[model samples]
Target: MPDTSRTQLKQILATRYAYLVRRLERITGSKEGATDALHETWLRLDKANVSTQVANADAYILGMASNVAIDQHRHERRHAHDDDVDVLLGVPDELADPERILTARRKIDSLKDVLRGLTPRRRAILLAARVDGQLNREIAERFGISLRLVESELSAAMKYCLQRMQEAGDPYTDSRSSGPRKF
Candidate 1:
């Protein structure tokens, strides 16, 4: 027998175009989407290998149209639209600009200068408590000083750094200023 399935499908599509469009519109929820699906179905028919005969040509064509619509939807979802690309491009970069980077370097240099200006004992106490992550009690025992003296030295060092930073026109906010250092 001839490829009657393909021929029958083409005839049905040509004859029942409007009816199929209405049915597909209901299935796809939009006239434009339904029209596009039917057009895609027509294009796919030329490439399809219909070796076996179809018992129900209308259902077969409708099923093919539905598959085409689903495939179209999947394809569209895989690629970003122009508006999506524009929105992505409009997002601000997280990296600091050159001027911000220079300002940050200057602030760091100012902090280094402030650290260098501290007395050796005070600097050592501050570095031990803050940078070296030593406990105040441990620092006091290591330096042969009382815990009260350790706290006093750490506090003075912090206040001196804060004053120097403020005078340099870039104040550093201390988050732990609410209470004494715990660790």
Candidate 2:
């Protein structure tokens, strides 16, 4: 609970409720958990005996939501079900085959090697775009390069990775040959 009046908390929650839910979802890894945490947050805020005026209502509410999420995580950890025992009790295992797992590891290793072989700038651009989920424009701004250059580097890196994957006999490769296919 934050040191804010209930009225202010309610107002902040009303306006930015959706955003808070999305943030909580990112923290909790599921919509249901986020919803539950939000509900708990509302309840806690309603019962909080705070009289001090809050300078920033949004920050206060976000803090409360974060606390609720942490509590929910702790509760879940306490009651976590053992997967091994559950599997013995007729829970269907959608586990991957050992051969498939081995193939995946090999492909991952090959991709890592290919990425390692790239120029530093190209590798950084590709990682910023793909792994960090940065937009090309953002990468361009961050790297102090033109957007076109960023796109070119990213594309070249992707092509190299795809070519290496094809050479490694990647099952997901559309064309059977390692060479470029006629689209």
Top-TM-score structure, candidate number: 2
RMSD of 2: 7.7
Cα-based lDDT at residue 3, candidate 1: 56
Name the TM-score of candidate 2.
0.55
Cα-based TM-score, every candidate: 0.45, 0.55
Write candidate 2's Cα lDDT for 1-183 as tens digits: 454478678877877889888877877889888788778878888787766777887778778888888888898788867885577878655667788799889888888998998999999998987799888888999999998798788779888888887887777966444543111
**Candidate number of the best lDDT:** 1
Ten consecutive residues with minimal summed lDDT in candidate 1? 171-180
CA lDDT of every candidate: 0.88, 0.80
Candidate 1 off by > 4 Å: 1-93, 174-179
Pairs of colliding residues, candidate 1: none
What does candidate 1's lDDT look like per residue over 67-90, in tens digits? Answer: 999998899888968998999999
